[model samples]
Target: MLKAIIMLILGLSVLAAGFITLKRELSIEAFSISSADEAKSEMKNIFNDQRWFYLSGIALFMQFVFQGFHLTFEYFFYAFLISSGIQSLFYLFNKKELDYKVCGVIIVSFLVIYL
Candidate 1:
């Protein structure tokens, strides 16, 4: 129960950070990755086209329901959420590019988180 609660809090925090990173692009933060401020094609593409996150979230929730919120599942999911959030921040800081460096960070972070 305690582990699950911790995982929920961490996952939600990371997910919120990811959302904020994406949202920052839409604002006039001077680090905008949109093709044009007037048109905002990139922002639209990110907001409208990202469906995997929704699917993953639903899948995890379903698994939580089915497994009765197993601790192992929550631990892994929390790690994944944090990794994704860190990657989003990395991409946001690096001109919205998901490069090898971000991938490396994901890999390293997961290994550290799991092991």
Candidate 2:
């Protein structure tokens, strides 16, 4: 049915975004390793590694669960918005640069779905 197809597409798109965000975060962490090593001269703690990725992944997974429960495009869209907001908050907390373009994409995608 149309609803199922839309949900599938939305889920896949969100998952793809999450994966890309994770990849970017990992790359940044790798870049920061040298600086961190110079500061501490010790092995990095895994708990402190790639925190944004973990947080974003959790938020995205929660969105996925919410979407799956509703089976409606609107719910999926809202979930995406909420997930993006959560990710933005994580970025803010980490004092890292935020991507307004990515946030715009999420918001625009949700508006499109709502329409």
Candidate 3:
């Protein structure tokens, strides 16, 4: 019962972290443009940014982690693996630097969960 409760809390916390990161990185208020073309251009620029892919990968990984914790470990192991791989790929794609340390902790946790 305590494990379940803790899982629920952590799941929710991961989801909240995802949302907060999204809000901070992609805030509409920050893109105050006077023209439609400029708005479209800005949108295109934002989407084209490598951070978008990095964020998407992170969001995917975190979402899987949250769902995995909320449900059963056996069921979400593949999902966790796929999402974690994608996250790592995105991180690698974002920059040549090896900055995939963030997903390392998540992969380790999921490995523990798998065992």
Candidate 4:
């Protein structure tokens, strides 16, 4: 029972962080391009940008490290939550999209909570 409560708190905290990251990402200025070609060009430019790659790499690396370890459900739950929070921090600081990262965090959180 105590473990369950702790898991709930950790999960909620991570989810909240993910939401904040999403909010920050959405709050950024939307790009405006008159033509599809121009938009594609701009998007490509953004996609190839080093900052995005670095952020994504860090997030992925953290996920790998968290998942690779053999941990109890409670530990995994707490570690994932903390990792998600860190990822959210990365997004918040770097202005990167949260998207699937948030989803991954939520799914793992629930799995750990119920398991």
As a whole number from 0 to 100, the lDDT of residue 39 in candidate 3 is 89
TM-score, candidate 4, is: 0.34
List model 2 lDDT by residue over 1-115, tens digit each.
5545544655565566667678887887444545755656544453454644544444454545644544555554555554454444444345444454345435544443444
TM-score of each: 0.34, 0.31, 0.34, 0.34
Q: After superposition, how far is residue 19 of candidate 4 from its true place, in Å?
A: 1.1
Per-candidate local distance difference test: 0.51, 0.50, 0.51, 0.56
- Candidate 4 lDDT score relative to the true structure: 0.56
Each candidate's number of clashing pairs is 0, 0, 0, 0
**For candidate 1, lDDT tens digit of each residue in 55-115?**
3444344444445566575545644554454444454456445344345444444443444
Tens-digit lDDT track of model 3 for 8-96: 44455456656666886887566467999998998898577464345345544664666554545544543444444444444434543
CA shift of 27, model 2, Å = 1.0
What candidate 2 gets wrong by more than 4 Å, as runs, is: 30-115
Candidate 1 ranges with C-alpha deviation above 4 Å: 1-72
Q: Which residue window of length 10 is worst by lDDT in model 3? A: 89-98
